[model samples]
Target: MIAHNNMKSSPRLENEHEHENEPNNLIMKKLLSRCWEESRLLWRLAFPALLTELFQFSIGFVTTGFVGHLGEVELAAVSVVENILDSSAYGVLFGLGSALDTLSGQAVGAGRLERLGTYTQQSWIICSATAVALTPAFVFATPILKSFLHQPPHVSRVAGPYARWAIPRLFAHAMNIPLLMFFQAQSRVWAVTAISGAVLAAHVALTYLAVRRLGCGLRGAAVVGDISHWLIAAAQFAYMRGGCFPEAWKGFTVRSFSNLGAFVKLSLGSAVMIWLVVSIGYGSLEFWYYTTLLVLVGLLKHAKLQIDIMSVCLNYEFMTIMVALGFSTAAGIRVSNELGANRPKETKLAVVVAVSTSAFMGAIFMAFALIWRTSLPKFFSDSPKVIDGASRLGYLLAVTIFMSSIWPVLSGVAVGAGWQVPVAFINVGCYYLVGIPLGILFGFRLKHGALGIWMGMLTGTFLQMAILLAIIFRTKWEKQAELAKMRISEWGGKNENQPLIS
Candidate 1:
């Protein structure tokens, strides 16, 4: 067996590649072995991440569900408000925090444990500032919706107040993301999952009692959601500072504040990547069209005509969001780890495994969506008209889920590769220039409606995926590994010969 740790030089990596052309059976065996190894690593990080995201996603869903029970008006209000958060502030700050992942993930791979805390601290500062900058948008969400969107009276009335009530979550998410990235880098996601589980349980009870028992209406649900976010942030902050991962924490440092330029630049890139990925279609026109549909349904008072369709859209989004979150995390971590360790070939291999796995999962989602089309909407609504309407859109939802399954991992790859800046431009071109305009042309000009909007989204997603795949395939992995090493060295501290904290 080749000694990976000792084989760090250029010649060794070249020799490793030379072996790629070994007899077909030998190559196949090597590939299979790698697949198994990569799969285990990916799944460990992914499963917990999946649950954590679900728990996070559920906070909004639970609130929406409780609010949904009150009336369609309330449901529509909360939904609009929730999407307001999702499509804007949340994505930008989360992206800024994700900058820590690139630094910390590679730090872990390079055994520079102390730098993890430094990156985490820097991320916290950046994310908090970004969140503060975005707070006014949340504050004015309703007016913007009312004035800009020209929403109906009922939706416009409640949406603003509900957004104001939930404003605390914006800050909670800011603090939460740095901690989450810090922990994920060390493969300590179980901590997040456990915390998320406890938070989720508390959230469910809070939403139930606050909405149903206390009759707090939208205000109650919004307040509870804010509380959940803060609680998670506080718990994680305390745990990490207390004793968790002592090597990584090092009780905080002034060093974090020292090299502002590099960190800030990286954070901006990371923020742009997050902002683009989260807001692209999920938060952009795809969201726009869905919002338009809901408004049309509510305005026309044709709830019966579109309830099932909305339900289908919700379920599709739920499934797609979680799966995308899971795979994206997997891909980023896997690539970052291998790149840091200077295993360029293995880094490429990891991307292949992660993307393939995600694609396969997408296919499975597509199949299930198709198979269970008729029965699926029952979970969201019981009305026969709603159910029938949902059935008609089920196939379309399946196609959407398939896209959701693939693109996020590609986004993750860009994150891991530290190409967030360039990729942000790609995201804009594919999603806004290509996808959104196309959707409008088809959905409105050509009369495709929701399906047309989705087609535009799918086209954007496919283009994004293809472009990302092209970048991955054509990348010179060895140079990336080398760059990672240089970065860790630069970030670690003064003395080059000193042992890494790990």
Candidate 2:
């Protein structure tokens, strides 16, 4: 009887183990399916932003094409000055605005509606102060430009008007970015898309009026660009104040110095990282243009014209980058929200979706870049030499685009997860230590020209992406949530033991 009882108990234990394994297998399958679904969701969220980015690029290309008709000197001056201003001002504005997606996403996840408003208000104050501080740089534009580039007397003459007219645009962007960020954090992405579209339309109208009707030449174009930004900012403000974002706009007090300090502490690393990468990368290209190519090859040559054509290509590159950034922003928001809600599995799914979708987008961009290599430059200019040069670089740029797509998405994931410090450090290491140095050596020292510089930058980007990928794979979302709670407590002035997520 005792032997019989033991045999019966052994079968029951085995049956129980099989029942447990069945549920575990089902959970695994569900997770895999969720990851795929999340990718589709990210694509849906990012597509409008991508369309907006393309529209913005069209505006830039149109501006450049118009300026190109004036002559090579005008084209060169516009390219150089625009690059500098964009790297300094726009880069900072974008970086600061990214903080909104980071903080507000988590706040929303934690069900802290009031905190979202506070974050938006704080971003405006901090970004506005930064804009004020940056104004002096514009005041000293000529001297600053001369310090970097061997600006020929004629180039300096044209660049002066362009820089002066364009400088104030940065201040306008300071306001616009924060407002856009607030909308984006709330997943009101269509608002920004509409605003950006309207801004671009206004810019086109103003560009035509300034250049053709008013005969302001490039100066008119610059002035119109600046004014359009202010118009966009005003429109966004009206929309927000007109009851679209009443909850986010309520109790809006000017941020105290302490709050600003805290915001800066959270944001400066990412800002510095972006600034350094953009500045150094553009600076390297400009240095190559002035030192190596511009002097050796005159404007009449195929090479010189090709260099001008590359500017148009660069605009397309920017569009691709912005698309990637859009998805990254969405990923960051989703991941942050899930983490804040203490849904580790969901956060992991969001990250997987972001990375995979970015990879697919990168592949698509690469295909387009390759297919359109010959015809792309013709859209901007009539020169065959320019088109050929652009085609050669276009192939390489496609790879860069694909690689870059992964970066913003993965970086966004980290940002949403509050891994900014680590990501910032990785950027510094890859971009500054590896990318810049290699680009300088290849472009200037080895005289490989623009292609060499791009190769170096691409290598650095690849390394940075790799590091971020490793971090994402190894991270424990549960632990991240605990840390986030601690941070929220510190920020909200709550007890250490207080749970922010619940």
Candidate 3:
């Protein structure tokens, strides 16, 4: 209980009446209590998510770090290919995976637990089909890289083999993403955390053996991820079958294949929204290329591969920063869950607490970036030139991290509120219409290089954040709660393709 006496309580019996008359004291007490309560809720949801992102990213980071050691060619090949994959495939596929967040989170809250399994199964079909369609891109990556990207011949050659080797990742991605998203929606993330941790360790060890001991080179490094990711997918599937989700997983059913059209439309909105959100801020590696073309065009041919080193260093920071990204995911789930249950006040509190916590996390990242501005590059490479280059990029990295801390939670609110279709269009406007064109102007016309490009992206981010704030404030929370309940009833009850009657 709050110390009511700690306030300016009038000691005299006559003055004691003044305390009760003022009323501000009680208001303050209630405000403080609500903040404390909301903070606890935010932490509980975000922390496990933080662990899940950390472990998952660690496995990929280790694989990248291994490639960073194998020579400049390997570094350039792996980094660029990974960058392309992130931009083209990962964003779309993972965004589709996030569809589970929308369907299952609300389902759990609305007490429609059995629907969670069917939703997840529906995602598998979509992601699998997507993976198959995209696999050919990897097969022909060499031609695309050489013709379109203008990379050096050696980089193209090395990337070709690795691209083919990396196709298995898509298949594994198909299996793994839905499982993790299903677990996350239900808040059964400790299982994901443990499984990811084990996978991280195994991935690191196997990558060392493949690259360092067995001399697998770039192809070997890529293959290690295939093994590691499949292992994770298999393990998580086992856990699901082993009574982890007794209510949700009612074995396999034909219902999963029943809602293809509905699932596709929903997944597309989610994919586009998430892709735009992630690509503009985090996924688009090609952003660096535009800057290089602008500022370093004079030395382009001679220094084609130099940008890879900087990319590697930048990827390192992005990977570690994934922990902060968890707030967005958690916010999405909590907001959706509360809304589904028709708890309008609870939904609003979750949003407020999530935004506040994310801002605090951003400040922490800003501090870390400033302190380790120089020393942290040493973790990725020993080249003094690369280290010095990365050090110079530190200020930008810090600002990026700070922005990342806030923007994601806003995106989460959009996700939780069932505004995916509208948000996708918003992202395109913010990222492509405003961000990219302006970034190009800054990088090319202003000759500010990567820093200027990032500045443009940051401008877009804050703009998006501002618009999201407007929407959130304008939203009728009670109406959204009602919508969530109705959506759950409609989607959970019958054929998703059929139009709902008014």
Ranking by TM-score: 3, 1, 2
What is residue 292's positional error in candidate 2, in angstroms?
A: 14
Candidate 1, residue 227: lDDT: 93
lDDT of 3 by residue, 1-502 (tens): 2567645343665587877766988888887898898888777777888888888767667776788766666766776677665335766576666667787888888887888887888888988887898888799888867776666767777788888988987888788878877887887888778888898898888899999999988878888888888888898999989986788998887767766666665655435555445323232222332332222321243444455545655575555457666887788888899998999998888888888888888898889888988997766566677677778878877877787778768877877887766666666677667777777678668877656666776677667778888888788899999999888877776553442222
Model 3: number of backbone collisions: 0
RMSD of each: 8.6, 6.0, 5.4
lDDT of 2 by residue, 229-301 (tens): 6777887787877787666667555543446656655665436564343322321322232222232222222
Which candidate leads the pack in TM-score? Answer: 3
Error of 3 at 37 (Å): 2.8
Score each candidate by Cα lDDT: 0.73, 0.68, 0.73
Q: Which ten residues in a row have the lowest lDDT in candidate 2?
A: 282-291
Local accuracy of candidate 1 as per-residue lDDT tens digits, 1-502: 3566656676877877777666776979988998899899889889898888888777877777677667656766776676545545666675666567777888788787867777787777777777788777668877776677655565667778888887788888778888888888888888888888899999999989998999988888888999998989998898898786888888767766765556875554435555445323222333443444444333233442443356446645665767677778878888888898999999998898888888898888889999988997665455566578778888878887887788778878877777766776676687668877787777667766656666766687678778978988899999999988887776564463343322
- Prediction 3 TM-score vs. true: 0.88
Candidate 3: residue 349 lDDT (0-100): 82
TM-score of each: 0.85, 0.84, 0.88
Error of 3 at 272 (Å): 12
